[model samples]
Target: MSVKKTKVHLISGFLGTGKTTALKSLMAQKDPNEKWVIIVNEFGEIGIDGAVLSDNGIPVAEIAGGCLCCTAGPQLGNTVQKMLRDAKPDRLMIEASGLAHAASVIDELKVKPLSEELEIAAVFTVVDPRQFVSPDYAQQALYKDQIGVCDVLVASKTDLCTPEVMAEFHEQAAKLFPPKAKVVEVQNARLDIQWLDIPVIEKPRYRLKAEVLPDNTMGFQSEGFTFPAGQDFDGERLTHFFNDLPKMTEGLVRAKGVFQVLGTWVWLNWVDGQWGANQVSWRRDSRFELIAKSFDADLIEQKLKEALE
Candidate 1:
């Protein structure tokens, strides 16, 4: 008898491109009868994405501290093996770190024993249109590799983009050598669940250039902080702090945190100059993490402390 293989889907995107939001959207639409599991990888040691996703009441395995494409590859494989033997879910979803080389992750998954038990259903890459058209982001080697490795190209945060930006996104996407199976726009990372079933089209695999090192060596640094449950932040001051983060710190690219603010809990997200805080039911200890080109961690911690209630 042929062994039953579990279907797996990989979601990849650059820093702050809304991969977690997209994963949440997909999870919300999952089949009630089917058991599903999520594996989230983060560049920060604190594993904020895993914490946020766990709130949905699903079992989440987190691989933190490095990119799964390189340094964390062994851990990722082990996690998959353990999940398969224990949870035995009907489907599996992996949210690759924003800075990950997705092509390498895919290659890892297709190897030997793991490949025999897992079938890659589809690969999705989320893109922020504003960044997609920007020369700075477009020129990045990892950014281009993420796009090249996916079956579906997702344009997230479309609601915040201008018409010109959207047009340019289409123009650039059209220029990709091997066209994507589908290119769709989404608002707030609300991807259509049906897209997950899109058939995978075989394409030339993307290989990383030798000179490209792991994320830690790529000039990016990350810092994470956790506060005890009773701690609360001054909402007004916290908002101001996030709003002025780019000016207050150099090379800050992405920052996210869940904090007890005023009398309730709120989740704050800041990416490339856009940010918002929304009330949430999360009751865990407050935590914050930021990824940057470089920053004074001591000073950032001091500023955060000053915003406490």
Candidate 2:
């Protein structure tokens, strides 16, 4: 008698592209009777996405401080093995770090023991249309490689893009050699659950590079800071602090933090010159992370400290 293998799906995307949001949307539409587990990987030391996703009342395993395809490869394999043994979930969904190499991760899952217990399902890569048209994101080798490995190309945050940006996104997506299985535009990361059932097609044309590069090869540095649960931040002052970071700290590209503000907790996101925040129910210690081409650590710390109440 043979046991049924667990279905595995990969969610790949670049930094700050709303991959977590898409995962949440999918979870909402999942079968109520089936057991599902999630594995979230992050480039930062602190696991913000994992913590946020845990609010859904599901088991979520987080691998942080490195890319799952490289520095965290051993950890990724170990986590998968343990999850299979302990949880025995009917389905497993992995949200790879924005900087992760999808091909490398897929290779890891195909190893002997793991390959026997898990079957790769459709892979989805989420793209922000605004970044799709920007040279800063479009010209990067990692960005193109991410799109190259996807079975589905998800254009997220389309509601925020202009007509020109949307047109360019559609044009570029259509030009890919081995075309994507499906290309979709979604708002707030709402993905249709039916897409998850799409069968995986093997593409011999898509090959992984012999040498795997470290996450830092992209010239980005990341730092994560945590504060005690009792620590409180002045919401107004914190807003000003984050708003000034891009100008105050050179090379600042992405920054996100969950802070205790007054009697509530708020989640703040800063990316590509845009800032957004929302109230949330997280009760964990206040924490934040910053990713930049390069920046002064001491200066950033000092400014953040000044925002404390």
Candidate 3:
């Protein structure tokens, strides 16, 4: 009997570590004819990564509101089955929530139905180099667990860090990471496509496991709004509104959406205290998704309505 196999790349990182950016880079290097499927698990209810990849015409499956390793495990299994049955993808990549522990995901994939079909290529964990030098890096168990589970260590956002910091990061990486893992550094999360083909030996699973909804994700939440067609947002007004959102909404972390602006469409993203808007293809509905620790959704909706009016 012949067994069917699909290569799997599990990408893990914390919030704002640039897993999506890495996916974009990797996708650009893909052969046009090859089919790749992405399963994005997000901690917040509003899924931003899925939207971004979908915009680029990539097939994406999103699991939102909690970590796939915990709350969305069943959904992950179901999604995998559907993707294999319908999409018949050449490869599969899972972008785990920043707050998740990859060991659970790996163990999940190892079990029947998925295990019989999947050939895990490598486990890649992206890290911000700046975090290596921070005292909090050692203190945060989630971060430690994320790193401990990966077969490949990816240092992302290297372009923004200093040479001294990079050197220090390498020093720390040598000591803390699994001896067999390969380390690579990238700016803007742009990793080499060849790295995906490098086969890896699976590490032992983590013994300590948390419930599907981990404590770290308790403070995170999301809200979304949809505007009907032709009820376009004013571009200038929208920019100002997003700029003022962090100040107006307590615990505001990120806000993003594709909006019909002045008869055209644009993608707006407010993240990590900065905002950017770029022109994108048209979508039927103009919608916004917000992620925050705890914010008043009514106030946000009212403020946006006022801006449009």
Candidate 4:
């Protein structure tokens, strides 16, 4: 029997969502016998999270200047491969960018490079305790999507919010989240480190261990599309499309992409929400890729078709 225990834990949230604190807390609570490989990605040029995890002796591999969902895809994948080859750690934790959408990250695992080794254990998204009460969150599309897609949603920094505020936020967030994922509060900095030890990535008896790219996307049950540079279109309309998506979404884990078009080519961008073109028009081309655990592909297709048409 193979003696390798390769499982991946993805921690995704928007900026200042307390991913670092949650990771630090989780690492501190974990048993020393359990070795962990942390893959951290951020927009900042320097790798701060990796250094923090390093202080805890958790053998960290940081990938800076990109979100773990896309920019750091190869680096994260390679770092993970090397870790397995060298340290053979018991578990892996991917501290994704605060802005990362979990659906896209999980979708990457379903296809190439990562599928060979790593298996996702759990998906966690950290919510800033204060944001739920803020007017910005109440109106923002990304805020709602981040909370809705995670397998485990944490109302972090409970100490700051009053009991009533916490309770109301919990009720509101719970209503927005998927029925399957569990939501909890992390106030006392207490976390059940045991969850990592539980073989969370369910192994399929007959799994698809194959390399996938644009052409072979559909077979994986998690994939997206990319249009050529000439396919540039309206940006505001695109955003409006995604903004209205949350109402009809089903099984959408996470989705984000960077695109380019004339005058907008220099400014590469991303889209993450229930109602949006699952693409980014950055290079004068319409490139969009979406990854989901399981979602209403037909509905997504219908919407995109309507928007593009």
Candidate 5:
């Protein structure tokens, strides 16, 4: 009887492949009438994408840790529900983790007791310049699913490679999909609002099974830490402390959590750097959680201890 109040725009991509860049670009140009909320799988335990947007004065809701398709479903649903209730955004953009399967995300769009106000807008799958060619390429079922479901396929960093490679790349890649999706490579991934509304048939819903990860290489545990009233931490000091961690963590996949430094809550992110110096502050959310793929728990525990000391 009532029109859906918001449409969900799912932006699925792998880690560090420019989904954040595209997302921020689109959000900044939005008309105020079109309030947009972003659900990022990574809240910058590495880069400050979310913090930068929040600092620029745009509202972003992040559901990080593991892949959204696998790990953050409840958080994703709850965040969406809250956004519809509070901000009533004209569009909702969810940036799935690089490891995330877009099919699982679509199935989630059809969640039980579907909210009356939520409409499925479109699915955008982002690919890196090098993604389609790597040995790791075939391992990326998430990437393929991302493409198979997209109303728009965004190829980020097209200027860095040749048209021949890009074209051949697409031709080979096309074998992965049905003949319905469009692939458009961007110069620097400059996205406009019009790109957000391409129409495609709604995909068949996906079902997910529980995956038991091996304990040896890449798995993570999350715990919430709360600072009592009047607690204070030095932000600059905290950043430098974690920066020294890269040397200690060699096989680590990713690790990040929100914690207090100088009384301001900051997100600490890491992605297997030789050193953790590449980390940046998201400057939001007091609550923190960590995700690791192939990290040794003892090594991570040692690094974490060094951070707090």
Candidate 6:
């Protein structure tokens, strides 16, 4: 009997860094014969990434409500162990929370039962070039630590960044960090599969914090609502609701979820100032996640409830 060791890839990045977009591209190019599993963790209580990944027909496990560094760590381990026992995938990919500490996740993977059956393939850190211009981001601990912990650095959304921003990021990234295996730019999160083949040789220098990660430490809050199972939202009404979200909610950052729309389900996504929605396969529970720096959760919930009425 031969033992199969699953190759595990950890995808890390700050919020809006295109980790999910990159995963979409990778999944599109997956070999037909290979069985791959993805575990998605979101900082928000309402799980959105799992819905997005589930559209691809891949096996997905979700750890939501907190980061893998703390609250979701045990869930992550249990999910991995179960997947290994049942699915027996050829590879495993984890999309951790944007604010998550990659070093802590790696530390978790290296412990006990998971370490016995899994091999660390690569840790990829995604960067949004636009963030390079933010002086505050340069000062953030999670942003800086995310960069420090990856074997490969991927600058995503290249098409959206100006030439000068790209040039500046390239020059600064090279000078700032320790030498890594690879640093590449990807347009629309189109990552190369060859990078995934590289084995993890050097572990990250950032150590996991011994203390519990403080609540709302990232200065962002998430409020989510689950709609009743039998209710269905009118498409026009839902669109109107999302269109008005940015204007109504104070400090609104990102919103995502699946809603039951007239016997069909549609996924709506909003980030920064833009919103988009598309019809998707049906999901029983209709819900939404609102991420903000500050907001009146009750008011937002009222607005959504009225929209469905």
When superposed on Cα atoms, how far off is each prediction in RMSD? 18.0, 17.7, 18.4, 12.3, 16.6, 17.8
Which digits, one per residue and each the tens of the lDDT, describe model 2 over residues 1-309?
Answer: 997999999999998889999999999988888889999999988899998899876789999999998888899989999988998998999999999977678768877889899878888999999988888987777887687667789999888999999999988887553345689999888899999987554331222121221265677666666675457899889989987888766677667777878756677888789889865433335667677777777787788789999
TM-score of 6: 0.62
Cα lDDT for residue 175, candidate 2: 58
Best by TM-score: 1
Model 1 misplaced regions, further than 4 Å:
202-309
Could you give candidate 1's per-residue lDDT for residues 116-232 as a string of tens digits? 898877789999999989999877778877876777899998989999999999988875533467889988988888998886533212222222223666677666666765577
TM-scores for every candidate against the unseen true structure = 0.64, 0.64, 0.63, 0.59, 0.59, 0.62
* Backbone clashes counted, model 5: 14
Clashes of each: 0, 0, 1, 21, 14, 0
Better of 1 and 2 by lDDT: 2
**Cα-lDDT of candidate 2:** 0.80
lDDT ranking, high to low: 2, 1, 6, 3, 4, 5
lDDT comparing candidate 3 with the true structure:
0.76
- On the 0 to 100 scale, the lDDT of residue 183 in model 5 is 69
Q: Can you write out model 4's per-residue Cα lDDT over 168-218, one digit (the tens) per residue?
A: 877676544122145678765445676554432222111222332223444
**Models sorted by TM-score, best on top:** 1, 2, 3, 6, 4, 5
Error of 5 at 78 (Å): 1.4
In model 1, residue pairs whose N, Cα or C atoms come closer than 3 Å (at least 3 residues apart or on different chains), thus clashing, are none
For candidate 4, what is the TM-score? 0.59
Q: Candidate 6 regions off by >4 Å?
A: 199-309
Residue-level lDDT tens digits of model 3 in 151-253: 6789988889999999998877775412325889987789898888775532221211122122554666666676764576877788788888887776776
Global lDDT of each candidate: 0.80, 0.80, 0.76, 0.60, 0.58, 0.77
Worst 10 residues of 2 by lDDT: 204-213
The candidate that wins on lDDT is 2
For model 5 the local lDDT of residue 45 reads 43
Whole-model lDDT, model 5: 0.58
Please give the lDDT score at residue 279 for candidate 1.
53
